[model samples]
Target: MKTESQLNIIFVPYLSPGHLNPMIDTARLFARHGVSVTIITTPANASTFQKAIDTDMNCGYNIRTQLVPFPTAQLGLPDGAENLKDGTSPEMLGKISYGMSMLKDPIELLFHDLQPDCLVTDLLYPWTVESAAKLGIPRLYYFSSSYFASCARHFIHEHKPHERLVSDTQKFSIPGLPHDIEMTTLQLEQWVRTKDEITDFMNAAYESESRSYGSLYNSFHELERDYEHLYKSTKGIKCWSVGPASSWANKSNEEKANRGHKEELAQEPQWLNWLNSKQNESVLYVNFGSLTRLSHAQIVEIAHGLENSGHSFIWVVRKKDENENGDRFLQEFEQRIKESNKGCIIWNWAPQLQILEHPATGGIVTHCGWNSILESVCAGLPMVTWPMFAEQFYNEKLLVDVLKIGVSVGAKENKFWASEGVDAVVGREKVSKAVVELMGKEESSEMRMRVRKLGDASKKSIDEGGTSYNNLMHLLDELKSLKASKALEKTNLKI
Candidate 1:
């Protein structure tokens, strides 16, 4: 074996906050377990989590970041526009995808040069399956979402239940899942509803997953044990549930605050002070994640809704342009709320984990992103689930119907964030009602209790001798044995 000390694994994270952050956290967790870990990404993308990696290295963990050139200029994108959050328009997003595709060859070459024992890459990079095979290494597909979503998608794709529906609003049951999950055609992504180029890409990705050695999920065994069972039995792949990775990796407030992006906001203290001023579990936190741009009308409705709900809130607003349509109205609303001391509007990029862990934060208004859901669950907070696109609707079902910890805002359409318009906007009344129920109502007490228990389970899952911890140890042993077996085969051939 070529191993000097321990098994070496390379993590290839996709270039986005939701995907990038947790993958980096998982890499750090692996490093903490005495594995040699290297994260390979473009320079601009690496800059987002470089500080966190540096901290791990300083702590004497065997972790490092390897940089590659981001083909921004070649793809006609502006410098530093290497992440999905950097793409302001559909055209720019296309350029970013094309640029990412251009890196496949260079990344494969690195795979050959590094000669790691295993390749753990984002689900987006389906091509890596072949690269890992060429290098005679195991490839573990990194799924950043829940196992419930994965099983739901698999059944939906296999059964084609949505295809039999008459209207987009008609509900149908997904077949062969452990839980009875129902979803309307409107809730599914456009690619699932119809055949397109994206559909082909997704199909290729899943096929690659099935062909790979195994998969890694950022989920815990207790959170979705039934769905986890269903996923493995049907897909017939070896997998590990080692997650709540954020909590396990960033154990302290300082590490949580500096988890992603190095920029220090001048208004950080203001928000922290605002959060500190509130009572325990008294404030609502609203964020639509790194993607998901709301229209001007939607922003105005959200503003009115939060104001009318009679709750203290800290909303992370991602304004497209200073002169955009709702700029004047948002400015006026911010001033009024500021003077009233009722709400705080953070311009962009709030410290999410820090805010969630704060004692003052009670509930969340989330776009049903998996990362956001896990973070909230870990914080023991219920949610007002507003699913916009992707597998979010499935996640919403897990929260509202299965978990019973979320109140849905009754969002009806599933449009991509960039393509969202006023047509699918949940009115201010719906928003206000959901928030009131999630934050103030007596029924919310039960929801809080259930989530708190789950939060405790999430913490225990990562401790020594826990399910996730044991799974990690087993996976490492398997990788090391495989490496030794390969070395024996080579020796036999030489003899």
Candidate 2:
């Protein structure tokens, strides 16, 4: 089974933008390094990766897509509602999880036919571990969060420090991690609190991850060298922190140091050109990734905050979100901002990477999503943390506490702003101050320098002979060795 014809790998991503994007980047990374990569996802999610896959193939890299029908009818979901981003409500999100779980049989069959050298999958597909084992292939669990979050989760699972606390709102120290990070019980994920169906799924996922050959994370060693080493020492899992995976997008342009950020550029060429016309480090970029909905009050506050901060900004307001409370208020505010000519409102879907890379961009007001965090680091932009849900609060801790490159807008209570009412809206005054501090203050100059250094390190990480580059090479060698050993065992059994 060990063929010297280039190594082939299968990547199975969960049906969420947060999960699929980084894994797709990692798949492309492998392809650029001479590995044959096939990314398998539902038909609905397939289009998101198709353009990148086609681009890679045209460049003569071995990358392709395999689409399976999502169980929309079986799961009572609407047509084409395969991804979490498609879910209109929390109840629908639960349905998406149910639908993803139903893919076990189909994925197993595909594994039987593809017979890849190794399996790489999102943590959601726990059954893939068994599937890989059945086919005599190794499995690597892909974690798309920060090493700090990983270290916290790993320790929290082992220790149960929260059990001793009385209230869910009470703050507690995360035990066993190298960092002195403290998060409220409220900030901890819902699954981490109780034993529900979601908890059950997570337990199965963690069990499968532990049983697999190793874990792969979208982080680089230099970013969290201490937590990186601490994770391996504590978990005893063969782990690879060959990431800041957004950097992988640049690996193909080994010649042009500029082409890696092209994936998101073509979507809005005009906006990028406009951003370039602004002052250096003068434009504050505000975007709450995709899926975090904002209430009317929240949007108005941010509008006033950005205007009051007196910094030119490019704020991305998702078109769907504009209809959430009242489009009139948003329209009026947009007109005021436009007349002032200090702000640009992207109705929906702007070129995020290109805007981030623009020289005029100074600070970011982000939801603290891990992907955004890595991208911000790559661009060397300081941030104003506004975490809305999930492990994003943990990532905020890394940004504000460990990295010291951000100021929190102080969203201490953890709840999805999508349904959580107006209590979550950070006041315009706080937002104004955070923006002013990040974009103008002398003290914030340290944050600017620190983040720029991280940006440099991130760029260095994927270049030839870099930390992530070597780690990726080592992972490939491990897979090849495992393949040869499996083939030897197969031959011996035949004898």
User: Which 10 residues in a row give candidate 1 its minimum summed lDDT?
Assistant: 416-425
lDDT of 2 by residue, 1-495 (tens): 224757889999987888888898899888888888888888768866676677789988988898788899988889989888777777998899788878888878888888899999998788888888888778999999987887788888888888898897788898887668888777777788767887888889878878898999998888898888888887789999778887567443321222322234344455666786787888999999777887777888899999999999999886666664559888888788778888888876665676777788888999999988998999899999999887898899999999999999888666655443666678899999888888885959899899999999988888889999899999998887877887788889999
Q: In terms of TM-score, which candidate is strongest?
A: 1
TM-score of 2: 0.93
- Expressed as tens digits, the lDDT of each residue in 1-495 for candidate 1 is 224648899999999888999999999999998889989999988887888888888988889998889988888889999999898888999999888888898888888888899999999999999889888899999999989889898888888899887899999998987667888998998898878999999899878889899999999998898888888899999999989899999997777787786885454589999899999998999999988888777887899999999999999998773345578988999999999999999987888999999999999999999999999999999999999888899999999988889999998888876334666778899999999999985969999999999999998999999999899899999998998898889889999
Worst 10 residues of 2 by lDDT: 253-262
Point out where model 1 deviates above 4 Å: 1-5, 265-268, 321-323, 418-421
The C-alpha TM-scores of every prediction are 0.97, 0.93
- True lDDT of residue 158, candidate 2: 88
* Segments of candidate 2 deviating more than 4 angstroms: 1-5, 251-270
